[model samples]
Each structure stands twice: as C-alpha cells, then as structure tokens.
Target: MALRACGLIIFRRHLIPKMDNTAVEFLLLQASDGIHHWTPPKGHVEPGESDLDTALRETQEEAGIEAGQLTIIEGFRRELNYVAWEKPKTVIYWLAEVKDYDVEVRLSPEHQAYRWLGLDEACQLAQFKDLKAVLQEGHQFLCSTAP
Candidate 1:
C-alpha cells in the first residue's frame, strides 16, 4: 500500500530577497530523522480524512500553523509520488498564504527547525526534485496572482 501525505505550499508576500521584487517567501521545515531532508509541513494522512483536511491537520500538527491563520490559494492543487521505506508514497500540496506577518511558527518534535526562504534558497534546501518543482509552481502562482 502507498503512503499518503498532505501539506500547504505556504508563502508570504514581500518577504523573498534577491528577486528584485522581494514580495514572496516560502516556508520549509527540516526533518528530525532519516536523511534530515527539508520539506514543507506534511506527514502521513490519518484515516478517513479528506486530502485538504489532511493538509490542514498536518500543517497544524507539524508547523503549529492552523487553518484559521492561513488563506489557502484558490485553484491550486498538486500531487507527487515517490518511494519511501521501499514503498510508494504520494503527497499533495495546496498553496496557502500566511495571514499575519508577526504570527510565530511553532514546530512539533518531528522537525528540528524551520526557515522562510526565497525562491532560490527554498528550492535549494528542498533538495527533492518533485518537492522543488512544487515550490517553483507555488511561487509562480503567487507571483502571477500578486495584486
């Protein structure tokens, strides 16, 4: 059976640096185990949960950022498939924006640290190809939709 996970492609406007525009920053979390890879706030989906619900729940559980604190972007959903623990895994991501500049990110024990990074840095830290692609897409969506 395939493992399933979900999370938000969270970004804050006007926070990215070196882009000249500097209006979008992305969120990434460093895992506490395994390869110590960096990823968005996500984890295995609990039973009987909608994908979006899983995303929302995992975001809160992993990043301590609840649904009420973010505005999920409209018309954006992405899926990625990979191998983990010798089995297939699928992860879904939805674009979301942090509603307040001063809101603190409280991470759970599953992660060691979190960082808000701009396009280049975020892509670099994400490392995983599929994850970096997702971030790129999310960043593009934010840039195109900026007011």
Candidate 2:
C-alpha cells in the first residue's frame, strides 16, 4: 500500500495575530531527519483516522497550533504524490489562516526548525514541485480575493 500524509497550508497575515485578507505569511517546518527539507506540518496517517483529521492533528503536533486556532480557507485542497523510500507517497493539504496566538512553535524530533515565510520564500524552500505549486496557488487565491 502507498503511504499517506496530510497537513495544512497554514498562513498568517501582515504581522497581525489574526487572519486578514491581505499581506499573508506561510508556515513551514524544517525536517530534523532525511534531507532536512522545509514543509508545512504533516505526517503519516494512523489507524482509522480520516485524512483531514490527520492534517489537523499533525498541525497541532508539529507546529503547536490547533484546528480551533485557525480558520480553514474554503474550497482549497491539493494532493501530491511522489516516490519516497522506493514507494509511492501521497500528501493532501488544506489552506488555513492563523487566528489566535503566535505561540512559539514546538518541533518534535521529526523537525529541526520552523519559519513563517512570505509566499515566494515558502515556495522556494518547499523544494517539491507539487507543494510549491500548491503554495503558489494558495497565494494567488488569497491575492485575488483579498480586500
């Protein structure tokens, strides 16, 4: 069976601790192991959990942020598939906006660092083409609708 992962494309706006229609920033975590790549909070799905549930849980576990703390952007989801460890892996992501605290991010041994980046930097560091494309699409969607 293919490996499955899920996560949020969590973003903040213009230095405010709230979600706004303009000036967005994105959350990315640097991995502690493997190639040490940066990405949105995500992980393998566990027993009997839905993909969306895993996304929310992984966000909380990896970034110290919870689903209740974010406003999920509606009508936006993306799936990426690539080979890892000689097998296919699929990752699903949803866009969300941070709304409460800017608490210090906590990383498990799975990640070594974290950053909140503007769109371009986030895409550049994302490295994976599918993820970069999703970041770009999310930014475009925000810009087109922001007042």
Candidate 1 versus truth, CA RMSD in Å, comes to 2.2
Q: Write the per-residue lDDT of candidate 2 for residues 97-145, one digit (tens) a residue.
A: 8885475677877888999899888988998888899999999988877
Write down the TM-score of every candidate. 0.92, 0.90
Model 2: residues with Cα > 4 Å off, grouped in runs:
15-21
14-122 per-residue lDDT for model 1 (tens digits): 6346665656788899999898899988877888999999999999998989999999999899999999889999999999888996668998989999998888999
Residue pairs of candidate 1 with colliding backbone atoms: 14-23
In candidate 2, residue 26 scores what lDDT?
91
Q: Give residue 133's lDDT in candidate 2 (0 to 100).
A: 92
* Candidate 2 TM-score versus the reference: 0.90
- Which regions of candidate 1 fall more than 4 Å away from where they truly are? 15-22
Query: lDDT, candidate 2, residue 115?
Result: 91
Indicate which candidate wins on TM-score: 1
Q: Cα lDDT of all candidates, in order?
A: 0.88, 0.88
